[model samples]
Target chain A: MPASKIDLSPHNARAYLEPGPIVLISSRHGDETNIMTLGWHVVLEFSPSLVGCMISGGNHSFRLVRQSRECVINLPTVDMIDTVVRIGNSSGRSVDKFADNALTAEPALRVEAPLIGECYANFECRLFDDAMVDRYNFFIFEIVKAHRARRPKHPQTIHYTGDGDFMVAGKIVSRRGLFRPGMLGNGRS
Target chain B: MPASKIDLSPHNARAYLEPGPIVLISSRHGDETNIMTLGWHVVLEFSPSLVGCMISGGNHSFRLVRQSRECVINLPTVDMIDTVVRIGNSSGRSVDKFADNALTAEPALRVEAPLIGECYANFECRLFDDAMVDRYNFFIFEIVKAHRARRPKHPQTIHYTGDGDFMVAGKIVSRRGLFRPGMLGNGRS
Candidate 1:
């Protein structure tokens, strides 16, 4: 194809997953709490607990996250896509998403940011760079306290791709059939 | 759903995305050719153009890009995902991914890096932040040149959500249906 023809509209668009985990970001300035959808979060390092997320300046939660310097990354279920996309397309400046979606907010442990009760995983985070926020809309965070849902479900994580698209995680697929210790031939055994 | 019952295994499992956008990080090393898989990338800025991606600490491709502070971000299509994941999983240390993928490496006009012909969108990038990568495994690059696919298909972009699973971006829900202008009697509209 010529170098001038690729289109990025949402027609026949599919979500591309990077093979990582997903987390939602919840932030609050005062009594008002908001949740922004995300699948761009990644674990950059292990020691000292560092997490990275790229929030665009075009996003409303980006502003709140910048102001508070704190937010919660929550992992919602696939069933939450309708809500996720709705939040992504609409702005929190006008609509109260929690009130519109009937979602509840709970207090976080180490941060003032609120956590969405409907989410399965939550990460309370503190901001990393102040300059990058306005310049690149990308924020690196240090994870403070992590929380998991009270109940376990089978493959219940949700992955959000760009646009208004998402995917529900499938069953575990390992190198070996059912993952036997001797099955892996990498010489680790 | 008990917090104690939650297993962090899935969140920690390392997986590769087979079908996703192929980003070519083209760099030059001592008059030698260098190009590698760069799927951990995203648009970070709108005006003045910026992008971000992650490069392993020991990649030869990144070493050259760091030296010149210049590179190119090329976006491939679904047809090229197989090659994308292959290079991403394997290292450039053992094999030349461009030759393995049968891609043409041509020097960019604005940057010293080469551009991959297999990709649909190509962006010439200039280093934006070295601290983000040195500290957080995050590297930000600004786009100086961009090209579209030779053939434009439907508007579909791939996103890496996690695991080998991918979610195809579905239709664009109507913004008018969700919230019409002046529909909410409040002046906030």
Candidate 2:
């Protein structure tokens, strides 16, 4: 199938703005594998770590996460908006979405989940046994490994709005605080 | 007090690009009250209904969420990005951030937590239980009331990419498969 077209104009920007994280949640149930878009996810902890996401009971990916207790949280940039939307809209119940969308999938080093090649970052997570999954459709996972893509001079990403709209990463319009060495915070500046 | 400045650009966009929902968390401890930024949050379930957020144990806001078992989740759109960033960087620990930042705070109808003006949406939540929070620093909340700012022509929202970079809301790039009405598959397109 031809890749879905994406428009990043400011006028149609909301499609990308709603709870904006686009994660490729990959899992395997038995021998079958699938990937889905998840915006209802977050980092839960930093030490000995934990991460969590909300998955509706209706999704096939939810079942896979439940059964496997593992998944790869693949963070995609705006460049992968079309692919993210494609996988999100189609249910893996019947469609072989990976093959359908032509998304390149690679094995995760620490988890059974697969990672999408086009994404900017990948987090390999193992399910943290928690009680909220049923009470709130949320699952907490522990990050085992993380990878950042080759730095881009202007690496923009996509955010999800309520509807089909999406938002492309934008510029840093302003700045505050210090950037000099010997200052309190130090890293990339 | 003047708000502290943060050069969000240093994180090279990773600051705003974190794969999580940006939620405004509010709490009151004794005579002191505070609000802070939370992007490490998610909705966990629907049956008993619950919400989840990852908070640093050391922050004042975390103590509020912990002591009260009650908190609020305020969702803001792209328009509120400036306020969000301002509140995210400034702490209510020392100063009245609301007054300093020109932020308006009002009592939530359902919960004691305060609702922030200028945000597009809000979710009033109470802690679901203590089982997971103690182990993972994850707080799952039960939503009591949910509201949105007057509907926008296109309700695109701001998404953080990490550090100080954010993604701009975009348009409905395209769609596929069966026609739906809301948000890609839910129907609206």
Candidate 3:
């Protein structure tokens, strides 16, 4: 783990995930470890810090995640755009994603899945529900632990717009005054 | 209804929604109509154009959408950030969101819900599956029709990060050359 990274409350995962950046899902089963780029995900809840990820059935990581019932959601910044694309372009079945991409795999606090040290944030997740997995390939996971960089309050995240295009995170704008006091969950208002 | 808007294929809905922008969902039940701001949503599939939205049961629009089983997901650009926040802060039960926000309620082609004329795009959706709704407040909708502005290929969409703050959509980056031919669903590659 990087010294610059700090532990974060799992409940505050929404602050980093709600923006919908493309994330890398790292998983492990027995001796095998894999990483896959994923964008089809949503922040489902805050208290338990639940997130829903739609992993395609065809992805090699699917079997690993389904078998282990756990994975690490890694948030990569815009600086890792090329690496992100490359990770998404290749398959983890034949090549070891960590060694192939030259990404550092760091130990996570709560999950067996390793976290990508290059990512700005890493959320350790446990499968909370598998009810929708058979039908939609949607796995609802509860984020049990979170780690993020201490500096750069807002990192430039990359959002996939499909068809090989990406949208970078831009300027931050606040409407704290316009929000109802009860609606501001983070207490920043 | 605007001259600048054009009909789009339902499969192409990912081009507008995959980026994870905060969207305005318009719903109608009987004679009542309501609009609510939603950020918890994910693109579930492409061929059927499925989208999973976790609409909190407490929201006023929840009942309207649940009863009607239809909605118009309106994409509001960065220019409409204030309106988006205001819509999210207020309740549809007390205010006529369309009239109070000064947004035009244009009739949708496939759903009874009216589309926000000021939005960059509108996707008419019908509830595809309700199995997860009771357990997760998640509604799986299949986009039946889509409409978007012809110009300004990339709209500056706003993404919520809790605590009343928003991140606006920034520059457009493409890695067409790096993508596998089969992965480029839009045929641009």
Candidate 4:
């Protein structure tokens, strides 16, 4: 091993594992609705938009998602980092995250979970797989609806690098004529 | 909706869905082994370290992985951007990716798949889930072994923003005293 890249302790690798952007997820089961910050989530498929996230069984939203099988993934920008951390630190089991965060709930197109109006983009997803929920607390969701800030074109997203630190999206560089044909067009910058 | 943000088409959301870092995954079945580029992979858990990834049935590695059930997730630095895209654009069924790209394969500690020597960190993963393989072509992996470069401290990692553009990780920012005490400290910058 070189002096530059250190062998990360596998146990703590999640800190450097590119813990995708911290997003506020809204889950509703009947009358009980909850919002929580999620840092362990990622895109799984391009079409039908399958997404996977690890939601601990102890989380209040986990129960709501289990009963309802629906939730909205709200992508927050760098500006919302503080709010993201606050929501993450607290649990929805006791506190009403929506009221605590002073966030507005907007009706989504496809799911019962309302979208966080403050977020840069919102994805309404239907739980696609519950097979690994007990063993790993993982949920596979198929995004049934999607919405984003088209005006900003590209909002500065926050990526959690553990240690309360973040790396903001900056400097967009694209490779021309690299993508295989027949993949989506908008994927081309 | 605020003029600052817009709704994104659900079909093309992957472009902005926080497409983590593209990794070179090497898989072997019998004598046929292959390396493929993966942008649709993510961390599904922290403890047992479960990872979820989309491996299209069309790829040669998918078949190998189906039979072998093991592969290595190699994290490449920003310097390997060109090679990352090249490996992604091509397939392993027809050409030898290792010879074509001059990537060196090293022995792994816990898995049969060899590590990519040129990458910064390597995760030897064992296939953990096959339930969704036929339907969604998705696989769940357990990172049984982990290896990383000790030098370079923190190498600049790349995040694909769709198209040919890539985001080079820059300037670390930390949120002081945010993580749980027992979570792990070395993740601190």
Candidate 5:
């Protein structure tokens, strides 16, 4: 079934991204578009909705994102494990990823990049800083728009542990009672 | 039983950290020591065993880590959930975390920062780059040494979502056959 998504406040991006799941980064420049499996990313800030992605120079999508200065960060669930592995193993330079994988590429609200409709959540991001790009291939982006699946309050995301192994998102536990009033919803802790 | 740890090659740090569990960063400067609950971290590189941590300036451990230029990233298991919540709730400036929480601090081999004896894994890190510190509070650290428990190979680690919720690490799945030979253990994925 196609996932139903609802618009989310960009400020609340930390709720989805802080858990550190493996994400599929989709990029488009001119006539070229590509999707790459990415796990090296960090949430930098909550207000501007910043995230840092380290796209290695070797990946074909790296040049696409670097030139376009925009991309869509898509959260893929455990059901897409095989597809994720295929995307990570193949280079976009050689394959038409969307057509080959039979994944839907829907129009993003803010960025030029296309969002994967089958994914649980999609964050349209615009490049906020390129200073780290030259040295580390790290692009700090502002999540201009966010969309998440409405039904599954907590999606079963996959996290890479190298060597073709992935750890699936498990049970949810809340310590809200223990957290101070100030720290409960601030997104810092 | 106390964890019987075996030394791991720093290059293999990705196997433990790329999964993106909430880590406890322990740092020491002079006679003072501190530990902070960190969720914003990413495995940046494999060769130098580099990891980037976004340590917000507000945390008391920020000053200690910055001054010492060294820290131990400790991976806590699901069993330590309550301790993790308490540590994140309290400030290191006011509390001696090790003493107050009854978390034993063991001398590290390479860094002044002590390792959390109870953690599943400990990676001794040295600050590699601080250029992004002032602007983003992101510090790139090189893992100089690594250690992990022998038993419970797949530890149940916790990943934090906002509002005091956590997602525990779940089942492991491997797609080794799908990965190309080169991508199997290189750690880029």
Candidate 6:
């Protein structure tokens, strides 16, 4: 099922939807810290490890990120989908997200934002730039430090397919020896 | 398999490596057109759909995109991995990508760029803003028009894992009736 062609209406056009695991981004400003679910993000570069994420201007976390300029991107596995959805539905602006979600905060190495102990990997990031914030509501970041389970703790990560559905990442298939170098070999984070 | 933690070396920390399908971007300027595989991209908004992607200045397509300020983001499936990798490996400045790879070119709706016939979906995008392109090498685009197969012809699209490996999207599981109004359904493109 590779080359068949069919025209799709604009209303139904789903191009590259969500691809990566949903992340729990923790932000801090002053004495308050907030946690929220983030699915709109992408890796922007390799060497400096840049990432671009979209945070609605209305979200409470956006304000915190603006003030603190730091956050932790925590990757949740498939087992955490239900909790992820719950977090996504709830607002971090009103409640103590950590207590409401029963999540733990572990200190990060380089950023003030704490890591989500429950997730598989945590990237302690510092805001790299925010030039597009006004027009696109996007934030550019650099992973100042990162952590992961030695062996995948929950390798079965889930990607949201709008309408409260998901697609679990399965089986590893490499195009062995096809790499052209410059790629980080053991992508630890 | 959830609580174990390992400190990943910063050099190997690839926190959010592959979260979406790798796309082949088709760009044209004047009489020159080029195809380049892109993985560093993410969705930035829902309505008036916005996308953020990073294209290094070294790539030939970047020149075309800079001149045209328009492109088609084509989503390739698992079956097109080889071709995708090949296109990624070769430079568009010297070679005729379409002839070498045997990819088809179809007219687009809102943009001057042509769609890749083998791709599962094509988003006709226009460069909305390029202010951050200098410092971050990021391009903010808005999907002005889109098209997709009525159904996911290759439901199993591939995500590029660093170092020539990839992860295939597998198994659909949705949370029925959980979506609030306004979420895109059966995302066609």
Task: Please name the candidate that would achieve the greatest TM-score relative to the true structure.
Answer: 3
lDDT of 6 by residue, A122-173 (tens): 7778898887788777887887766665445226677765545677887767
lDDT, candidate 3, residue A17?
86
**Judged by DockQ cut-offs, is candidate 6 incorrect, acceptable, medium or high?**
acceptable
The DockQ of predicted model 3 stands at 0.74
Candidate 5 chain A lowest-lDDT run of ten: A180-189
List where candidate 4 sits over 4 angstroms from the true fold: A1-19, A183-189, B1-19, B180-189
Per-residue alpha-carbon lDDT of model 5 for B1-189, expressed as tens digits? 225788878888887788889999999999999999999999888888899999999999999999999999999999999999999999998999999999999989999999999999899999999999999999999999889888676889999988989999999998899989998775422
Clashes of each: 26, 41, 0, 28, 0, 12
Worst 10 residues of 5 chain B by lDDT: B180-189
Q: Which number leads on DockQ?
A: 3
Q: Lowest lDDT 10-mer window, candidate 2 chain B?
A: B1-10
A best-first ranking of the candidates according to their lDDT comes to 3, 5, 6, 4, 2, 1
lDDT of 2 by residue, B8-110 (tens): 1111112122333466787765666678877665544434445566687767788887887887666566666777777777667777867876777777766
**Candidate 3 Cα misplacement greater than 4 A, ranges:** A187-189, B187-189
Q: For candidate 2, write residues A1-189 as lDDT tens digits.
A: 102222122211122222345677888878878888887666554455555677778889999989989887776777677778777767899998779988777767777777776666666778876576776677867777665554663356655544455555555433234212221221122
Query: TM-score of model 2 relative to the true fold?
Result: 0.74
lDDT to native, each model:
0.55, 0.60, 0.91, 0.69, 0.91, 0.70
Rank the candidate models, highest TM-score first.
3, 5, 6, 4, 2, 1
Q: Write candidate 3's Cα lDDT for A70-175 as tens digits.
A: 9999999998999999999999988998998889999988999999999999999999999999999999999998889986888899999888999999999989
Clashing pairs in 5: none
Cα-based lDDT at residue A8, candidate 1: 19
**Cα lDDT of model 3 by residue, B1-189, tens digit:** 556689888888888787899999999999899999999999998879899999999999999999999999999998898899899988988999999999999988888999999999999999999999988899999999888998688889999888888999999999989998988874211
The Cα error of candidate 2 at residue A44, in Å, is 1.2
lDDT of 1 by residue, B1-189 (tens): 111111111111111121133356777766766677654554444445555677767777877788888887766655665565566565666777778778887656677777776665556778877877666567767666555443432224343333343333333332234433432221100
Ranking under DockQ, best-scoring first? 3, 5, 6, 4, 2, 1
Give TM-scores of the second chain, every candidate: 0.71, 0.77, 0.96, 0.83, 0.96, 0.84
Q: Residue B128 error for model 1, in Å? A: 3.3
State TM-scores per candidate: 0.66, 0.74, 0.98, 0.84, 0.97, 0.85
